[model samples]
Target chain A: MDLQHIRQDFPLLRDNKIVYFDSACQSLRSQSVIDKIVEYYTDYPACGGRSMHKLAARVTEEVDAARATIAKFLNAKKKEEIIFTRNTTEGINLIANSLGFKSGDIVVTSDKEHNSNLIPWQVLAEKLGIKHLIVKSLPDNTFDLAAFETLLKKNKVKLVSIVQTSNLDGVTNPIEQIINVAHQHQALVSIDAAQSAPHEKIDVQKLDADFVVFSGHKMLGPSGTGILYGKQKLLDNLQPFLVGGDTVASSTYTEHEFLPVPEKFEAGLQDYAGIIGLAEAVRYLQKVGLEKIAQQEEELNEYLTTELLKLPKVKILGPEDAKQRGGIVSFYVEKVDVHQIALMLSEQGIMVRSGQHCVHSWFNAHQLKGSVRVSFYFYNTKEEVDRFVRELKKIMNVLL
Target chain B: MFCFIALIVFAILGIFSASHRALAKEAFQCVFRRVTLRACNTGFKEKMQAKILGKLINRSSRVAKFVSHRFELLAWIFFILSIVSTVWVAKGVYDFYVYGNCNGLNSTGFCAFDPKGNNSAVSTISTRPCSLKPPTESDLTLKNVNVSLFPTKNTQAKNKVVLIGCYLCDYTRKAYPLIKKFVTENNVQYTFAHYPTKSASSYLTAYVDCAYQQNKDKFWEWNDKMFASSKEDLFKPEYVQSLLGKEGYDVGKIKACVNSQATKTLVNKQIDQLVGTGVYGTPTLFINGKAFVGPKPYRVYQFGLKPFLFF
Candidate 1:
């Protein structure tokens, strides 16, 4: 509970006097994470595994170390199971393209998925003339597992892709259960853990998911860093998404041979600094303990949710309980513009996100106004919540 | 060859100066119909031929006969080449004017002639200062603050000031007094947001959250201490407790709240809320959401705010 000590690690929290509540969108960079990246840029800024020079060797070593760390963090069976990607979007796109979906094959996803997960499947289905199916969420904003199972049973579903945690609602899906059901029907599952990986501990082997995609920036790592974890066997069988110089083993004018699964998929020079920074971020997270971080976020989320609900005009979106909600509390005011409230809070030096929370389909379907979202992290405090509520009341008085 | 070129130049000059009777009619016709000027030599070509043939006849009659027989063919070829060369040069000049280069490749080396010396008049360029000027009420373009749920209609006694600065930043801390003076003197409106520019700014911003929860009224006092203290002593629990302890505040409660997850989450939310607000560094000041570059002189505010208030 010594956040002052913990807060010392994050420079942004120390320097900026404003209350920050938008960790779900992107977490602030920590000092250790920054140092790791700076080390790469300042000391050994060279291509990894491409040269025999000392700098290249150093870069290769750090890259290998990062790969091993990520493999262990995600609990991948083998180090080769993890692949570095630019971000979650690229990772999902890789899976969507490489998995070899055919015409008439169905890809199932939940209604609460982010656009990164949704758009890739939609494009895949369109390009290959395949079927993209959705498993609708219940009124409480939790996944409809039964409907998902029914869809899997009814169709020859090639893949079941879903978000491990909904970014908009901060609702963690029952991914383990969903994966189990998909496996029962012999359908492979790809979990978009962009929201979950930073906040929760992920074990690919434990979940028995075929693929997992998550971003580094969302988890206090560099912007372009991300990981796409797939089983070694599946990765070996899947086609490479991108192909170029480092990807090939040998080539003639007439034909070319690919090197291997991960390299063939990498295609270009990777973001070495970002990858190294992500490994450092994982180290930082491990030291802090994801469990403790999750607990802190949950506590803060509960406090904010309770305070927001007390307002007669405010309506909470997603699950009402904090345990289910994780770290985000989104709500819209009655007879007032949510964005205006966000502006007023901003004017008071309190920051909260406003709009559809990038869940346009869900918002549109539910006939709800874009809500003011107060997302929490380990660095948030109760006083900020109070100030935000006080400011909200003041703005409400003027507007209402 | 020089005489032949001079004769052609003279004939073209005759077209420009029609009053010049010294220019023979044959030479005038030769300029117009150069191809059909068999009898219109104006004695220039004949004199040149006679001079050349006279020397050639003395040296060898066969060579002189060959030269006189092919003279008309050689003359037509020379005339056609001169016209084509003139057009090519003109095209190069036109390209140079349009594209700032004569050759299609834009390399000055390829230009038929390097026109570099011709366009050497120094252009006097004037520019406004890179910094923003304080606006008068009539001159100021009012933009909606664009925050959701903020009422746009009412303009009353409320003075809205948005201070964008990092709590832990040395620059922001130093600028705080000037800002405080401005805020107190004007009494228009006041609010502040975190824009941490320092290495460990996030922690400083989060600490404010903890202090604010313990006693909302004393938040500003705790903030002043944060600015006043050295960066080294800023994060120490004992130092924070000692600073707030003088104000009859519960040190233990404030410490516990500061250490809580709530403070961390609030800090992160603030960072996200102001993500695209153009707040890269500390000490960014805004009035009614219109931004003004911070750490500016006190006079900037004196002038910047004076117009809006007077109007």
Candidate 2:
């Protein structure tokens, strides 16, 4: 409601001239979380966990506390379920890498994933002699329940990975329905929250996903850090994909043993400052009231998507209903090269992502070139949306 | 005549001074800053569109289930991370653009993506068409040709005049003819002599030793085979003779020669010579010792070669 007050929380908002709309790609960080991270480095910089010293101990405590905070935030069963990762991409890759699927086993995923979700399974399927089946989404970007049911009936599927919200169209999938289908097939589910995590409420327990992966940077946290929330049993069963310092419990030249659960997956010395900042970022969101954040963002989304439709030549993808969508509005204006449009949009100090949004198959299926995607967040406002629409009209007058 | 000469010189100097001042005024700073500006504008527009669309989509729940608090909390955390990732990635990018990776310093610690020194010299290393003073008799001994598509006619003969170093790394076709297909009723026989086996320097050395130095018939035979296909033990010296002998070559003497310190000394000598001329990267062709790096269009090669072939 008080956008001016909200803008004060983010240093990026202080720039009077620029309007940033690509929150699905990455959101602006609040000053409080950023300051907390800076404080950790300047006032109490030390390596987390390998020592008894005050700073080292604090870093370790803060990191674990952050994990606990994230676990609770996700409604995950335990703190141990949250494994810090490079990003959602790495988290999916970890499952695809370590699930130890035997030859002929199937890995089912929806077509709406960012390459982060698609590539790892595709690569792992090829390498491990497993089959990768892509469940098709309807033209509007909603999951085709019949296609998913057909794949589930085959019974060979070992894992099901889906993005909770489509990055391209901002469509919120019937992921809970798919999770139920996967469980019936005795398959584990991995939820990619790269696009969804930043703008929706989630409860991993209710969804019954074996793993839920999301990036901190997409929300307002530090970059190069993400969470891989896995069930403890599955986490224990999985092999370590990256072998390095922190992952090993003990090692000799002949035989080295891996550490248990989260530590085993952590591998090397992490981006400590980033992770510490992310923990503070989590705290900042909690204070803002996640519900208020959602309400504010919805208001912004309602404002932007309507204005986008005013340009007659533009075609918006994803579900037609606002209820089935997040804050993303993906569309392409006729006769404008998506890259050129993106390049032009940049010239006007607006940040939107173009290209297939790293989901190549969706583009291939639609037989369309790339589209322009503008996403929103809590800090965004109606006035900003009006300016953006005016800019679009100007851009259209120039190009279209 | 003196007045005319003074006028021309003054005009030239004035033009140079004016252009220099204009260059000094310079508008755009960096391409990256422009990228950030554009992203901001796009962000603003996206929000406006989402809102208007929301009004239209709320038919049943005109009440609107447009946002989820859970997903929002998730987004906030990820946004924090994106900035950190950008900043974290930026530190190394900055370091790389500066001090670089000299003396084995940890590049990450120094805020570098890798070693800054690695790419720093790349700009300094010229990638332009070289202009030299009139060619001396020593330099213009043979003609140069760049083969864009292979299985070229008289390739065996072409090897002698030009050391054709093929690029298999990029999966450009390496089509060495079958023994049955290569030697026809009237065809040049490509030899398998003096090819390097298993070393990183094999392609360059093979071009030098067999084609340039020896001019053996079996030379291009090995050259095509190397690029056309991949091998398991490409870097091993023992492999050269084993593979080449099967490809049909009488190289008992050549094999012994290649193993000797003399041949190794010669290969080293050639490398030093090329490096001395400041050869930065690979697939470099020294036609009569005049370097042509990367793939050249056949016409360009034809043009450059006509003078030597004619002379």
Candidate 3:
């Protein structure tokens, strides 16, 4: 894959000439994604499932097509299993509220999980009297499979909600093994692929994950669009969290019967433009091929991590092995504030996320200052990584 | 020759006192026409004579005459007063030029005819109101910066996410959802503090606090509506009342509290407290008392709050 050729598709990169390394936070949109969104606004500016007109029918067809495409991309059993949400947070909240965890029922999560996966369960535990169990990570920030197993054995585990990749350090959890362990204990598992989905192809069927949640914006789609894929049997069993206009089948003055699966969960008007844009984003990813995207990110991460390690007083978060990590490399300098470093890098037209990378629990548990996170995507290059390191060295001198 | 010497002195003083240029012109005119020599005095001695005799003559004419005769003593007193006034004016100008404010207090009005020209905290350019606060006090030992006591979504536990914003501000509205997402995503604790831009914003902020007083759940509902409203509809009491009524809130109680002196003081005190901390704009964030101004992208907040999270 030619890096230069792929870089041309992202207008923000070409126009701004910025070295964007904050893909872990949100990905830069390809022109295709932008065009798809524009097409929705200009050609078929109508709500789906609400009207019988040509424009509305076209919108409904396109939205259904996007859903089928997303279902196929994730390898879900059926399109009915794919639920569209505002983002991963809402997706997680829907499941957390619907799962019906009674008092004393334990929901286990990793220290490595993003707050999206962590907080909803925390709120559930507090509000409903359920047990919110946190499985601590190993010293190197790898998932403690042993600790996770111990928690499962000791308690009646209801669900094991975990992140596929640590947004803070890009440490990919051994989720397949985790899924097997949780299944052995008759516990369901949900995966937060917010950090992993963009760089890697997620086959929910192969992994046998009960639920998979990720944001579309993190994967080159527009903001306010995300996917929540649940197994058909599980989606059928769990109660619908949101209820409104489109979610119900039929309503009386006093009561209403809900629609089945995905429609039941997707309440009110959806971000149809964003949903359509997501289909284009997924096509763009598929055209590039997930394996190639993964390979490019690994190569970039290895180079960036190695260069970052060469610098004095730099401490990399998570495992030492770059291959074990995803597309991110986060680190901190001794006696220097990471935000100051980020601002300094920003002045050089190089962008990186500084601080805890939204995994504040990990930093708070470990008692360290937030690290500067440089997350690479397919469009990033060795040259940009070199520029980032050079800028970091300059920033270090200015900061110290 | 004496008049020529006086003219030279007046012109020289005029050149030095450029700020007092009008006064200098008037002095030049007085000296040019050789009008009443009393004009040359700038009313130092004669004004003193008038003040002293006017009071003395009220009681006794003999005493007033005797007092009026002591022009030498009165001249010395006038000379001393003139020197004191000159030093006072010079000090004020020096303070205004060096510190961007006269009287050495940011709260006080600047001196008249100041070259810097009403250097208020808000407008560094020449403008009337003294608006800018001092740099946000990094020292977090204050009464007004209240930590959020309620458990918000994502931040169920006590992890620090202090959001200082104006309810009426557009950026604050845009920022609220992003901030809420960030806070929930990290499972960090959250705090909402007001740094209102509009006078009406203070009441809106107080309404949320009052909502909290009535019901914490209602506070979140009120808070959401405040940020969600269009700029035109944001401060309208009827709109707010309608929203509250939809939520089944006692709008009467809220209305009464809004108008109450106690709640007004509570809101004003909180505003004063934040102002004291040096917050000048909406959407300023303080993660564990680490202050940063303006609304930033998600990544900036993600990484910016890291060090503070541990602390």
User: For every model shown, what is its TM-score relative to the native structure?
Assistant: 0.56, 0.57, 0.58
In lDDT terms, how accurate is model 2? 0.64
Candidate 2 or 1, higher lDDT:
1
Choose the strongest candidate by lDDT.
3
Q: What are the runs in model 3 whose C-alpha is more than 4 Å off?
A: B1-311
**What TM value does chain A in model 1 reach?**
0.97
The 0-to-1 C-alpha lDDT of every candidate, in the order given, reads 0.73, 0.64, 0.76
DockQ score of the complex predicted as candidate 1: 0.00
Enumerate residue pairs that collide in model 3: A115-B185, A354-B303, A355-B303, B121-B132, B122-B132, B159-B189
Best-performing candidate as measured by TM-score: 3
lDDT of 1 at A151: 82
- Model 2 misplacement above 4 A: B1-311
Ranked candidates (TM-score, high to low): 3, 2, 1
Error of 1 at B142 (Å): 51
Which lDDT value does model 2 have at A289?
A: 74
| Candidate 3: CAPRI quality band | incorrect
Weakest ten-residue segment in model 3 chain B by summed lDDT = B120-129
State the lDDT of candidate 3 residue by residue for B1-311, as single tens digits: 22333344455676777734554455455555555444343432233334444455446656655655664565456556666877897887655543334554232355574434333322111111245543433433334544543223335555576777776766677677878778768767677876667666545766766677777666676777768888777668788878888887898998888788887777766665665555555566666566544455465566556633423
Ranking by lDDT: 3, 1, 2
lDDT of 3 by residue, A1-400 (tens): 9777788899877754699999999999999999999999999989899899999999999999999999999998899989999999888998898988888888888887788888888887788899888988888889999988988999889898889998988999988999999999999999998988898888899999999999999999999999999999999998988889899989999999999988999899999999999999999999999999999999999998888778889998888789988898888999866776676567667888987776788888889868989899999989898888876775554444
